[model samples]
Target: MLGFLTARQAGLDDPLRLRRAESTRRVLSLTLNPDRDVDRVHGNGVNAIDIDAVEGRYMLSGGADGVIVIYDLENFSGKPQYTCKAVCTVGRSSRHVHKFSVETVQWYPYDTGMFVSSSFDKTMKVWDTETLKPAEVFEFEDNVYSHHLSPIARKHSLIAVGTKNPKIQLCDLKSGSRIHVLQGHRAEVLAVRWSPRYEHILATASADSKVKVWDVRRASGSVLTLDQHNGDKSKASSEAVNTAHNGRVNGLCFTGDGLHLLTTGTDDRMRLWNSATGENTLVNYGKVCNESRKRLQFTVSRGCSPEFVFVPCGSSVAVYALHTGELVTMLRGHYNNVDCCEFHTDYQELYSGGKDCNILAWVPILRTADVEEESNSAPTRAVGQASVNPAFQDAWSSDED
Candidate 1:
């Protein structure tokens, strides 16, 4: 560790090398933080969770009880242990509360002043953070499954929405209307995600066992329909016929760089793909036990070498290497099936919520070796330097005269 520090300080190693090493170690050391547990406010199962893109200080959670809660994750008590209390909530008594389960909740990418939530009631409502009132409402003919606003989009303020309807809706936040719809999937569109790399590129997953990538700018339809076989019809198995999965594809997430995409399905499998070409990179993440009939919410780690994907597996959160498909660890805290997991990239921490009506915080375990090393070396280094350096000798002078 000292050698690593010396090399890092001397500029002979990548500055991020130390950080990556620490991040990796921290990830491997992830443990349930009892001190940082969030207050259980939801009356029913939590359906979704999201950390804001801007400040990352506040977290949003939607529950099956039709409640939306915002929690302030910052510890202001100056104590080692502190509970993350709910700052505000759209309770059942609220007139603006969703009439049914809130399927998805997300903060506006650019600001925390606004947020959006979609529900099984067939409506997506945008709320003002300060007023706790709906700023805009999008009505649909079918149950809304999932929705997302591009964190990197500058050309437009569009929210990609998937629903029980096969068509994916793009709602314009700036114009306050449905901007357009992308049509390709044959079954209910379960998940929709905008590319982190290109503002116009979007990915949609559906119950029809297909994942399609569309260029919203082009009206001709999806640019590519992900096929496991890479168009090898002769060698294509039934499972490889222009489908991303063999069962309902319920989850979709892009890697931090937007160069790759990850999808999970009821087939108990997860696949990684090149976003540019839609070719299944075929990183075989074996049997990722998923049984959700609704959208599965998962997230990928950011700013870490060999990033990890955190997916809800039954009552636990499964952590796997993003590209290598190796299971890293299982966070087994939830008493019921975990519905959603959110990652805090800044601290490499994880927050997960589930039917158990609990939110668990997984934080990196702090290694004591460095602290011990510093403590053990401090006096020795000072004494050793006192012999040669006048500054150290003066600081330690017994004869003050």
Candidate 2:
């Protein structure tokens, strides 16, 4: 009877149980907006890119064929159909050939002089802009899917890496040795992210269909395991287990404040979970198909009325209202399936990459007069900010609309 029940329950994912999660995310109807305000610039399908924090004048991208590109995103010319020229690339013949498709590239967060890239070849390298040479290289046992450096980690100089192996590795930037490993994931870990609020806190997603939050300082065990059901015995364990995802949990990200975690699964679902507890928030993003074996990079608008989540769905990039789970807008331009995306807070701008080998920029709809308005509309309370846990308040008042 136990075996019969297990087999029957394994085939189901209870929608009612999922709906009973502490919070139900809303889904917004997306009104396709033209990506006019920001420029659509890359010539090839872009693999990755990063925005400049200080100047806000330049952007950088890495391509599928191993081309690292830099673009000046400012409106240099008076015309609207502006072209973004290749500033420089590490170019061909460089040993940094990123043996397989370049998986992820990111800016150093604080400065423009350096950036980082991870590859299927099982390595992550820090690159110096001036020489385009690897400043630091860390090699791993299996393919590296994704890696992230904290945006504001001041004390611990560590980079979190997710590889084909089930373990999460922490490599020290200040030292050359691998500091520690966070284990428990039984399948290849796909994404690794650090909490903005807690310096030592890290989160990981895996092929095992579990999302685990860890404390890098502890060797004990995971702090939380994201379960689909709220540990309700009335539901079958299979139904409880399948709650998180039916496929690989490929992408994981925390909101700015570290209260909520966003996950994109190969099962065509995007879920919001409370960071403090592993409770699935049940904000239903209908079908977010993430086929990539690596992390599906998504971004949160730094300052907005209601925060937004930018996820790369199948062939296009889908923007969803963070907590409500509504699809706000789709930024279409890349002829191929979009892969990764990043957001800039100060200007409320977005950039995305796809298999079509191009990177597109998206921004709010602005007229000439609206563009000329010299008003700093930055959100006052970081409301609607894509924070990780349950703490960030919705800064934007829906009453205004």
Candidate 3:
């Protein structure tokens, strides 16, 4: 319907004629409903949010007040305005729960029974969702910034953890141990991500202003180091290594296809790059304010013709078109600086949090007609799920192999 509207609104009779224009972009926003009343939260602020990709109807949020809450994302109350209900929470009573701010939270890509959280207390705890207890805990020497479990790594069930130490530790889930460290940067490693396109590939953005792409299977050298000032067309071998940003690189997010990467730096810039080539695309997102001393948690929209990037600005979230570098619009609601944002492609919704002690939800503007048509066309699935992603493949390979 969107494509049809784009073509008909332009009075273009042919499909080929409709494909060339750049004005087809659309912007919409739906007000978010918080899990509790706006004044009810402990009010320390929200830190992290994780939307269940497989089910898409449940999510988890960790707060600076050290509370972990699960929310149901469905329209169960049959009201005009739907509220996100709190399904469960890890309250202050749990002795082993994180004592300080929970910096990051993520679900095991393949399972609903397991989730992970890292805190300023220097520990990463893996929890059994049903039992709501720490199944395994890994201690660290410094504050952990972020950690990621490879979405499609089947051979190696490892979680890559970033910290103030500048080294990224790969923890093996099955063995319940730290396997090995990937060391390079001289400052804090703020963000760590495994390539969705390749199992052994890893990318790290550091406080040192450098973004390094590594082939985890190799110990001899880095595969590529990104430099922003290098000529756009120059290959990694031809460009000067390091110097990707003038300051700390705060945000690291990959497009849904994982062929490209989006980075935001304290240098107040955002750049897109070819993930495989390690070459910058040179899309100029003008002076995006990234005050995050820690890496920013941004998300990319999926399924759109040209996807968009959602990033947290001062007290609002800015939406920008990928590849084109055009600012779409800003989402305004939070009173304090927004820290993180997550996108849910299945329902065309966005969830973002900040230091304002509130989590705001955004969605495309929907009419009574659109909602009715959607309800008539399909049935909504129950929140949460059984089984795991078959997409999981072992990523473990010995140096000899």
Candidate 3, which ten residues in sequence have the lowest lDDT sum? 391-400
Taking all chains together, each candidate's TM-score versus the true structure is: 0.91, 0.79, 0.83
- Candidate 3 residue lDDT tens string, 149-229: 888888888898999998889899999999989888888999988888888888899988889888888985568888775
The regions of model 2 sitting more than 4 angstroms off are 1-45, 78-80, 239-243, 367-401
lDDT of each: 0.87, 0.70, 0.76
Query: Global CA lDDT of candidate 3, please?
Result: 0.76
Candidate 1 — which residues are off by over 4 angstroms? 237-240, 370-401
What range of 10 consecutive residues in model 2 has the weakest lDDT sum?
A: 20-29
69-154: candidate 2 lDDT, tens digit per residue: 77777666655545556676765667775766567777887888988888877888888888888988999889888888887788
Question: So what's the TM-score on candidate 1?
Answer: 0.91
lDDT of 1: 0.87
Note the residue pairs that clash in candidate 1. Answer: none
Which is superior by TM-score, 1 or 2?
1
State which candidate has the highest TM-score: 1
Q: Write the per-residue lDDT of candidate 1 for residues 125-145, one digit (tens) a residue.
A: 999999999999999999999
Better of 2 and 3 by TM-score: 3
